[model samples]
Target: MNAEAARTPLFDEHVALGAQMTEFAGYLMPMQYIGIKQEHLAVREGCGIFDLCHMAQLRVFGTSAFDFLQYLMTNDLSRLSVPGMAQYTLICDDDAGIIDDVIVYRTGEIEYLLVANAINRRVVFDWANMIRDRWSTHQPCGESAPRQGIDLEIVDETDRTGLIALQGPLAIPLVEQMMPEGADIPTRFKILATTIGPTPVLLSRTGYTGEDGVEIFTHASNTAAIWRYLLSFPEISPCGLGSRDTLRLEMGYHLYGSDMDRGVDPISARLGWICPADKPDFVGSDAIRRIREQEDHRVLVFFTADDAIPRPGMSLSANGVEIGHVASGTYSPSLCVGIASGYVPTGYSRPGQKLDLQVRRKQVSVVVVDPPFVQGTSL
Candidate 1:
């Protein structure tokens, strides 16, 4: 493996457990530990830990930090005023197409941490810099921390932060077992600054699995010890990218590049809630405004089927006319059905909307339905 290819601290552990490794986002991460099916089952039945340290962690500070984020992002961070709160925001290009999506965690009054997907690190950072530069010369970052640049001078990306995602039904219990006394796994969507054994870890009740889980961010120096400690939990198992992808797709959630991209806006992605009428002009406000007024087409409707499974870029047709195409899909272990989400005409967004997936030489019968094909033990 190339040293600069980037790796999570659990590289050795994943190899020891016999993971199938693959190159994703320039990282030699595990594609699957046992197998995608088995690992997917484990997350549904028990719990799983994923090494997510390769994802980018960006810090924006200085006096204009809040204002900078507002100008670039769609969601209003002002509503996320309380400490230990995390809100999902979409970064849009000038055309209102999604440049990327990130979660902004307000860690302090003037300091904010942005969690961006690994593939679009440079794109997001450059956008952040443009916002800072356009707003004013008053940089919001702390003077002491040199803006260790990736694609921008104002964005200070810590050289290292080890993040572990403890997911599945038993995630809360497993994480609590490894945490200190005051580390309360209190409710979903809340972030707590706590410790795992002796290491300071930021534990957040958020996950992509459509399960009740916690994502713990800690310093890289302590990752080895924490990995060993967390593995000791009877309910917590180790999972890799293969299972993670299937799990997220099973819930009808969007993946960054594959499901959403620069060509699509939130309305077409079934993410209309991200845009509010009263919110100030974000990057893509004008483009989205026209899309909304036109109501030209509907976003992808999620669905499940025992037969006729769909994959990304596959054709979705109605009668003899091609109406839409699959954006994301997977074989759901829990639902025992093939599930998918894709774009269709505005008239077909409702349930029981009949459509056909032109898979191979055959047209498979499919009907639109709701998501979370399987129920989570918690909400």
Candidate 2:
């Protein structure tokens, strides 16, 4: 660990358990514990616990927080009007380029919380603050009085909070056991403030592994105890980033920097689903709408190889013509094959299209396939 890298509250526990540490997003985090393959299977077949305190948690509150977020984010916040509801949204720049993919939850009638990738948290915060400053000086008047204005507060609660991701098919059952009597776990994509073993926790049935699970958020001071409590169940295995990446790869979930960056347009990234068409004006909405008018030149595609492992930055070609490069790739322990995602020309983005992935100096045959290469997930 470096002298400047941030350490989560569970860093000591990870070290004690013999985790292979790595520096990611300015934090010293566990890359793996027992092994990547075993940990990956544990999450697929049973349950896996993850230390996710490195993620950022920002709270937005006040009378106009909802409207403020609607203008700043691509997804329609009106859909999450009810408390406990959550939605996956994209924060984009003025050119419709992806800034960060985030999940926002309505914690109260007028309060909301957004979780951003650790690397982009500060960027998102500064962007929001800049918008807030502009809105404060140029509040719309007359007919736009009730609707187009902003008076919200942003709070950075990341350092004060700790997060744990308990994921898999059996995750719900284990969490149910720890909840207080007469209190039921929230449904999918919902959140609830509840207590577990005397500690107050914000439990949300949300995960990146495409599995049914809950992310528990509590005070940083209580994370070690909560982590230990969750692991008391013999069926739960402690997993790290290595397994987490493989698991998400199997489900075709996008990682922030690898899959999409600020320079990438959301349409080409296949994240248009999160940006609804009927929403009012938002950041990059006009540009995105214009981009949708034209045919997408390149679109994200998924593929699998028989024996070769396709790694990031590998080139893909069709008939000796370069198409695109791999964005994220990994070996699927469950499928016993290599799975990868990359951008290709629209003509070659269809499922079943054949392409050659350049591995070292050799060309490896790969077939494009629709996502979720391994199905039957709890999601």
Score each candidate by Cα lDDT. 0.78, 0.91
Candidate 1 residues 1-379, lDDT tens each? Answer: 5667877777888889888888788888999987888889898888888988878889877666777677778888888777778888898887778888888887777777888898888888877777656545433342233233323225646347888888887887767767776657746666778888778888888888888888888888888788888888777788999889888887777889877899888888877687786785666777878787875666768876558678888888887899888888778877777888888887887888878887888778888887656665454
The best candidate in terms of TM-score: 2
lDDT measured at residue 231 in model 2 versus the true structure, 0 to 100? 83
In candidate 2, residue 167 scores what lDDT?
98
Q: Give the range of the ten consecutive residues with the poorest summed lDDT in model 2.
A: 138-147
Which candidate should be chosen as best, given lDDT against the real structure?
A: 2
Candidate 2: tens digits of C-alpha lDDT, residues 300-367: 89999996999999999999999999999989999999999999988999999999999998899999
TM-score of each: 0.91, 0.96
RMSD of 1: 4.7
